[model samples]
Target: MPSFWSQKSKCLYFYFSGMMTKHKKCFIVGAALIIITNIFTVCVVKLTQDSQSFCPYGWIGFQNKCYYFSKEEGDWNSSKYNCSTQHADLTIIDNTEEMNFLRRYKCSSDHWIGLKMAKNRTGQWVDGAIFTKSFGMRGSEGCAYLSDDGAATARCYTERKWICRKKIH
Candidate 1:
């Protein structure tokens, strides 16, 4: 009724016991090797899992969101349409940290965002959230893009790169 592991361990002990009569640590060394092998196996699995990220292909992950920076240039409305096809909207800067992240990641070209000029307000995000963040924007009515400093207003028809964002669940 002995288990397979018990039988194998007994054989190992017997084999090493005969080979090394001077050292009495054959059984302990065998058990330690098994433990080390298991530890290495677990580490390999964890390393692979860490490399697999939450973001989809071609998207960059930051915090709980995934961002897609378009290489092709398109007008604000066209970019918005493209994002809609991808089940996402233009990037919406919700906080200073998010804005700074974009600033650091941005290339030389400015990218269209989800903000647009609305009557009697600084600006409005496409998500219907009230304008809370403050920045310098020009023109009474224009679409906003993520400029080098922050959000800047420009004509909606101006061709430019864009950013899309979606939450990671």
Candidate 2:
């Protein structure tokens, strides 16, 4: 009877030990996976912060975009051509923030934007987007420029300081 009890105790001990070993292995694997996931997440965040939104020299950085306020004035077509040479285009105000920013920063001088008169006499952006007419325009000409109060139109041959924009990414 004593031997039988001893054998039964040994059997129970072995069973518990095996269960503990399996649990330990599972815990180790889970920990390893968590560490790996954390490392990968950190790497992705660092890359995003360091590499995703770089701007060129002399361009002002703004929320995933870069804007260049030209020092020299040019006609609408010539200004567009100048921006293309710099691998950018005349600024396209896609939102109120951009519009307000340009309005505030232009500083007492009219700046030519991408807007121009289309064949149908509607204001169109250089990328072919129809102007939403978010604000009133004041000119009676073919090319539009951003002015102190809002946008105004002038002849395409009229020279004005301009804004250029390019995506950061």
TM-score of each: 0.67, 0.68
Quick one: how many clashes does candidate 1 have? 0
Q: lDDT tens digits, residues 1-169, model 1? A: 2122224334332234335234345678779999999999999998878656477799888878889999999999999999988888899887778888888887778999999886665677889886775556655658888878777788899999999998876
Report the C-alpha lDDT of model 2 over 1-169, residue by residue, as the tens digit.
1121124232222234234222224455568889999999999999988775788888888878889998999999999999999889999888888889889888899999999875565788998898887777786789989998888889999989999999976
Predicted structure 1: lDDT: 0.80
- Judging by lDDT against the true structure, name the best candidate: 2
lDDT of candidate 2?
0.82
Candidate 2 stretches with Cα past 4 Å from truth are 1-52, 118-121
